[model samples]
Target chain A: MTRAAPNPARRIREDIEGRIHSGEWKPGTRIPIEQELAARYGCARATVSKALAELVAAGLVERRRKAGSFVAHPPVHSAVMTVPDLAELIAARGESYRWEARAILRRKNAGGADTLQIDGIHFAADEPFALENRTIELAEVPAAAEANFAAEAPGTWLLAHIPWTSARHVVRAVAATRAEAAALATGSGAACLQLERDTWRGDRPVTHVRQLFRGDRFDLVAEFQAGTGKREGN
Target chain B: MTRAAPNPARRIREDIEGRIHSGEWKPGTRIPIEQELAARYGCARATVSKALAELVAAGLVERRRKAGSFVAHPPVHSAVMTVPDLAELIAARGESYRWEARAILRRKNAGGADTLQIDGIHFAADEPFALENRTIELAEVPAAAEANFAAEAPGTWLLAHIPWTSARHVVRAVAATRAEAAALATGSGAACLQLERDTWRGDRPVTHVRQLFRGDRFDLVAEFQAGTGKREGN
Candidate 1:
C-alpha cells in the first residue's frame, strides 16, 4: 500500500504561524479570507479554514461571523489545569485505597458554599483517608452530574461523565477546622492541604469542589509540554 | 446589515456527535469518508473534513491519512494539569510577593536531581516566602533556558519565554532537609508542601522541577469542566 500524502493543512498552519512570529502579520492585523488563503496555498478553502480554526482555538486569532479573523493581542497572564486519579495515586504507593459514598444531597443555596460540617469520621478504613468536601452551587451543577451523583461519588462520576474544556485549581494550607479534625481523627488547627477546584464546559460552569487531605495522607501530581515560542498561541 | 450564515462545519460536527451519542455510530466504528459525509450534509467536502478534524482533536475519533476515521476505544484513566501564577497569588492574599535570584549554575549529571542549594535565602521579601527547589535534567533544558539560567530563576524565566503544551505535577508532603530549613528559615523535617512538576512540548520533555513551599505559606487551586458523555474525549 502506498503512503498517504502529508497534510497540507498542517503545513499551512505552520506557514501562517511563521508570518505572525516574523512580524509580517502583526497582532490585530486582519488575515486574508479563507478563499484567498486557499488560492495562495493551492489547497482547498476548507483546508485553509481548518488551519485558521486551529489558530482561533489556540487563542491566536479572533473570528467574527462576518468581520473575518484578526490576530489577538497577547493576554496579560495565562495558566493551565489538570485532574488526577486518586485510586491510582494510592495504589502507586503500594497502599490500598477504598472509596465509600456516605450521603448525597440535593441542596438549594444561592450562596454556593456548603461546608462539610461533620463531627465524626466521614470514612474510616484500615488506614486514614482524607475527606474531600465538594460544594457546588445548584446553578453550576449540570444535568448529567445530578443524575450521576445519585449513583456514584461526585469525583469518580464526574470524571467519567463530563469532558471538560477547561478548569482552574488552587491549593493552600489551612488550619484544620474542628469538623476536619474530628473526621480525620487529627488534632485541631493542624496544617492540612486544602484543594479547591472549579470546572467548566466552555463558558458553562460545571461544579466547584473543595477537598481536604490529611497532610500525611495525599499528594497531587501533574505533567505537561511547553509550546515552542513560535507556535505558542494560547 | 445582514448577518453571516452559520458555519456549516460546526453544524456538521454536532450532527456527527449526535449520532455517536445515540449509538448509531459505535466505538471502533469507522466513520463515513469526507465525500460521503459532505454529500449527506449537502455541504462542501472540506466542511465535513473540518468537522471530522475537530472530533479527531477532541479524542472522539482517530483518523488515518490513507484510511478513514474511527471512534476511539475507551481509555483506562485520564488526568488533566495546570500551572498557577505565584506572584498573583501572594498579591491576592494582600501580602507583597518578591522573587530574588540567589544563584544560577550549570552542571552535567544524568541523575537529574539538583536542588537549589544555598547558604543564604534566595528571596527575602518582607513577609515569609516559599523556597522552590526545581531540578531539570541537562538534556531537558532548552537552549533558551541555558542562556536564561545565567540571569534569573527557572520558573520565573520559563513562564515568560516558553509555551508548554502539557505538564505533570505531583504534590506530596515531605520532611524538609537541613538545606531547605535554612533557606526558608523553618525547622528541619517540617512537613512542607512539596510540588514536583515535569513539563513537555508535545512529546519532547522540557523540564522537571520540584518546588517546596513552606507548608504554611502556600496552597493550590484548580477548576475544570467535565466533558459531556456524548463528546467526552481525552
Candidate 2:
C-alpha cells in the first residue's frame, strides 16, 4: 500500500490550532466558515468537517448547527497534580518560584464537617500562589511531623521526610469562601481551584491535605495509558 | 529497622472512619467535639486530634474553628478515568455493567473559551449512567467514524481499533447546565464531572474529547510511584 503524507484534516486542525495558540485568532472570534475554509484550503467540506470534529473532541472550539467554526479558549483551570514540590511545580515550567510561611505551630482544626487530627506545624503563605493546609500522621507516619519546612511549605517538607504509599484526591472548582478568599488574598466570589486529598501507605491512611490554587495560575493533568495486558504499573 | 503496628492516632482515625463508612455517623450529623471525642475514645486529645485530622484530609469530615468538626456532607467526588473502558471500571469492583447509546450524531461546535476546533461525533448514554463526546479525526484517524458502538464506548472502540502514540487529559468539575441536566438525567444545579482531553501520537495532536459524568455517581483516582525520579514528566 502506498503510504500517504499526513491527513488533510489534521493539518487543518493544527494550522488553525497554531493560529489560536499563537493568539492570532482569539477565543470567541470566528474563523472562515466550512464553505470558505473548504475553498481556501482546497479540500472537500467533509475534510473540513473531519478536521473540525477532532478539534471539538480535543476541546479547542465551539460549534453550533450553523454558527460556523471558531477557536476555543484554554480551560480556565488546567490542574495537574503530578506529585512535585511547590517550588518544583512552579520552577519546572520555567516560571520563577517563591514562597514564605506566616506562622508555624501545632494546631487543631476543631470545626468544619469533621474533626481533623492534624499535628503538623501550620503556616500561611503568599495568596493563592502557594497557600496549602497539610497534615501527616504523627504515629502511623511519624516521619511526617519531623519534617522541617524551614523556608519550605509543609507540603514540600512532608514529601521530603515521609514516603506515602498511596493517596486519594477529591478536587473541585468552587467559588471562594469569605474566609478562604481573604486568606488566599483573592476577593470573595472569585473562582478558585480547590483540592482536597487523602493519602495512604499500604493499608494505613497517612495524611490529608486541602489546597486552594488561583485558577489562572495552575493546571492539572492526568495522563492515560492503555490498560490492556500492558497496564503501566504506576 | 523495626516495623510495628500503627500507633494510637491511626487506630482512632480508623475507628472514626469506620463509623462514618459504616453509617454510624451520617452526613451532616453532628459528632462529639474534640474534648468529647478525646474522652470517649479513651485516648489523649492528641490522639483524637490526629485521627480527625486524617479524616479531614480523606474528605470524610469538615473542620471549622471553634464551631467544631462535623462530617463533610457534600458528596465527595473522585476522578475515575484512564481505565479505557467503563465496563472494566465498574467490573473492577465486581459489578455488572451495561451500556447503550441514547444519542450519537455528527455535529459542529463553535470554539468555546476552552478550545478552538469543534467538529466530531457526539455520544451520550444514560446520563450519569454514561456520557462521552469525542472528535473522530477524519483527517488523521480515518477509522474514527464508522467504528463500532454496539458493544463499547467510543473510547474503548478506538482503543481497540487504532494505535495512537500519545494522549493528554484535563479533568474538572462543571456545574450542570440546563442542557446537561436534561441530558445527564440529573437535576439542574447539580455538579457534573467534566474531562477535556487532547491526544497526540508524538507531535501531531491525534484526538480530542470532552466527557461529562454524573457527579453524584463518579470519582477520579490515579496511583503514583513515589520518587519516580521527578513527577510531571512534561
Q: lDDT per prediction?
A: 0.57, 0.55
- Measured against the true structure, the TM-scores of the candidates, in listed sequence, are 0.59, 0.47
Q: Name the top DockQ candidate.
A: 1
lDDT string for model 2 (A1-234, tens) is 322335777778878876665546766779789988877777788779867876765556778878777666433212233444555566555665444444445544333222223322222232246456666555555554544555565555555444233455665665556876676676664445556677665465667777666555555666543211111111
Q: What is the lDDT of residue A189 in candidate 1?
A: 60
For residues B1-234, write the lDDT of model 2, one tens digit per residue. 222335767767777766665456766667689888766766678668767765764556778898888866633122323334444455555555545555555554342212223322233332244455666555555555656565666655554444333456665655667777676676664555566777654455556777766666665554432211111210
lDDT of 1 by residue, B12-95 (tens): 787777666544776678998889887777788766887887777555677998788887653323323334544444555566
Which candidate has the top score in lDDT? 1
Distance from true position, residue B126, model 2, in Å? 5.3
Candidate 2, lDDT over the whole model: 0.55
| Candidate 1 chain A worst ten-residue window by lDDT | A225-234
* Model 2: residue A75 alpha-carbon error in angstroms: 29
